[model samples]
Target: MTKFVVVEGRTLKQAMKIISAIVERYNTIPILSHAKITHRAEGLRITGTDLDIEAHIDLDVVDGGGGDWSVCIGVQALAGIARAAGVMDVRIERADNAMEARISVGDGAAFYELQILPEDDFPEIGGKQGDLIEMFTNGMLTATLDKVSGSISTEETRYYLNGVCWHITKQDRRFVATDGHRLSLCTYTPEGGEPASRIIPRKTVKIISNHLANQNLKIYDVDTGKLDIVAPGITIRTKLIDGTYPDYSRVLPSRHDFTLDLKRDEIIAAIDQATATGGQRGAAIKFSNQNGRAVIERRSGDFGNAKVKTSTPWPAGKVEPQPFAFNSRYLRDVAAGCQGAIEMRMTEPGAPFSIFDEDKTMTRVLMPMRA
Candidate 1:
């Protein structure tokens, strides 16, 4: 290892980028768990990759040599120093089997030593091609992802819906996901971009939503059947799903003979009551429109049951009481944003039903079980 000049003034922002990039690939390989620092004439290139996803940043050094040198350090310590250390000087040194980083901020200075791994073991993730689409920064990207992300399936069997499906039509780019029980779909038009269809894996979409939420970023479609999301100094290449997604639009209820209009929270609380007595499977909720008030009742085989009577602002057509059983867990997922007002449309007790929020931008369809 060769000796190098220390950094006198490096912003917290630059240190954060280097730490994030290193940690991102730490778990990919044993060597990746260690940070690699290289010095060149241009600057210092801090890079990390797990062979699947990669992140790198080039920071200007105060004074450095022309030859490249590799020294591995613990990822956790680097991240901690980057977060805790304020503005000051940093002295990095390479020893026999370890690397030490001395961070100085204000009048306090702390030194940490981390075990080293061979630089050759660090993996590099090669870029691949998929489809790319550009989206403007605003509420459209974040809102769409937040509204639909929860509905993605955690089950490994139904692999198709495990991630959000990027369905692009001529007019709009849509995202759809389902867990075999309920489905959620959100759509937005690209401010200025091409239209293409792809399936973005679950984890990739989540990381992107967190980093790029409400921030403008370029979405690159790789030809290798992967989605490349670039936000600021972060880039995420998520593998695309090759399986066919279910025809979700067809699952939506077309027409309903009965519509129950009530507040989202009101119905959610009623469902919670039913869950307490009904066991994990869920209790039965009976809907009846008598006079003007809509009556909802729940009965539990084990625990005691309760009834919730709530009035609707809209007119309720005369209909017989419908006895239906639904998994309360499913109801909660659909009613998450139903704070203001919600509408439920159904044709029969055992038929599929649709629930809508106030804006109607999103709708959840729940299949009913026979009582």
Candidate 2:
């Protein structure tokens, strides 16, 4: 029989961090990436895995037993317990070749001998860290990535477009992400670290977003190409996806000749009204240049159709009436992102168009569908 003792609070946090990293990417198999807990004189070591994603946590709490014993437990249940448990002592024991956790939190005590899977079944994910750059802030990287990742494709077929693309300029410090539908690019100048670019997988981005929680983080070198993100008491190292992103500069309009300045709310209201008339699900927006005013029309198969005219229309120019139909949802997404006036640029009816703020700091592009 093997027994181990450790502080429940800090150890719980560390274990949860490792478990969460695997669980977020966990699949149908419960035992696939379950954590293995081992107790010795030093402390507790928790290991978790999901084939491609693997994590381990080492706790520094006092260890009572000089002997060693390893037991596998359900990480999901363990996480639930840790979230509710408080500062106390955790006594891990083995009885009848089974593992149990005798947990004490505050004035309450609970004993649970959870059925576990074989530790050998857990797959190992080879994680290597390359040259690492130190990140001192939290919200800056997390928030910027969050904004850009919004446009990432959820489709599995297009594997490359599924995550945020990290681009390091040869001279400037800028990061860019695009999903072929919408794009977000931002720049940051740091005092230190060499310029590097790598595509961060969607799962890793999500894990970082959930854990950062408005706290600062540290980036440490793991091996050669992989980096470990250390935040508070949690540490996660992820392998970067490799691919070549498309040239985004070509999509942007060199000269957006026609411009319309209208209240963000007003355009959103127009979209809503048009969408409602299209049907319950949604519809498309057809922009027609009728003389000076830009006529907006909505079409629906189940229901009927509706058209709404904008008050402050496009300025009179030599450009003739250009008609383009875009998914209503795509238009609304960009409109909701911007405040004040909405700027639209168009070169062709089916060609992609861009809607963004005047500052040009944050831009969203949408491709028009044939109506």
Candidate 3:
């Protein structure tokens, strides 16, 4: 229990801000509000969990003299201590009996004594795992989730849709989210893995998107409905939603009877301008197919009527598509997510419509509303 950790005060402060975010502000279990601190020759590792998700961050140490040790202390309080210390180096040492720890700055210029919880009481997701699967670059996983995050369902009744659904299609990984009104699907290449699917909770999706950047992660599917993510100095274990993800492929329109291509920025701007003059929330915008080359979106309000045009000819020899109406908010969100040009496919106004990006890695399905 003689091991101690020394780190720059400013560096400790920044690292604590990130790790403590994983610890809940309040919990009935005291240990759940604390972070597990482990120190070895290489550096210090700080970890926190909310039972469902566990994450850790590693910090380089200024001195590693007294061997290896582990302890648990209040995360929020530690961050406050570091902030108060300013640029001075901070040292942390555990009591001989291991029942408490002291965080000191500037040779006792400032110090705080905090009670320690049993390290073994801390919870982590651990179980028998199948073979670790192929690699997923941070850019791919984060970008895919960011695009679909807006469409993820927040309704409590059907809880499965509350997170992004990850699965394999043609050996490529696909992430999908929907709120029943609209669906967004993002595809990435995970290299190698047995075919499987899991619904990631919304909170976990946000945490991973924010912190796990620029590193390639290895994945493992555990037998207990949990997933493991491992990178060089980070490890995150998360529980998958226990429900089955809906079969979204059924909602995808089979044929591209008619396709209209437009610049991504142009369509989003048109959607925004047309809906600006609307009265209340949840306003619907109507898209009228005019001539063979143009479609007009117009919204009528008490002040005046607003009209904007997305002019692109229907593909040659295909039946002219009928005018369709959609929830303005949903359409604008899906359109804004496109990284490139928007290619829209439709059968009829009353039927399901599909939107594709120029690279074809992303797909969106929107249901039309009665105009």
Best model number under TM-score: 3
Order candidates by lDDT, high to low: 3, 2, 1
lDDT (tens digit, per residue) of candidate 3 on 1-371:
36688888988886677666677898999999988988877789888888888876788888755778789989888989989989999999877775999889977898888999999898876776677765677566677678788889999999999999988765678889998999988776645356778898998888777777666877777777888777776777788998999999899998877777878888778877777765756578887755665654655546467777676664655355667788888888888888787887888568788998875778899988975
Each candidate: how many clashes?
A: 9, 8, 0
**Model with the higher TM-score, candidate 2 or 3:** 3
lDDT: the better of candidates 1 and 2 = 2
Per-residue CA lDDT of model 2 for 178-273, tens digit only, reads 767667665555332355666777887776676665768776666644567776545576766656667788887766656666678888888887
TM-score of 3: 0.86
Candidates 1 and 3 compared: the better one by lDDT is 3
lDDT of each: 0.64, 0.66, 0.80
Please tell me which model should have the higher TM-score, number 1 or number 2. 2
Candidate 2: stretches off by over 4 Å: 6-18, 24-30, 38-45, 56-70, 84-91, 94-108, 118-122, 134-136, 190-196, 220-225, 277-282, 289-295, 358-360
- TM per model? 0.79, 0.81, 0.86
Candidate 2, residue 208: the lDDT equals 69
Best by lDDT: 3
lDDT of 2: 0.66
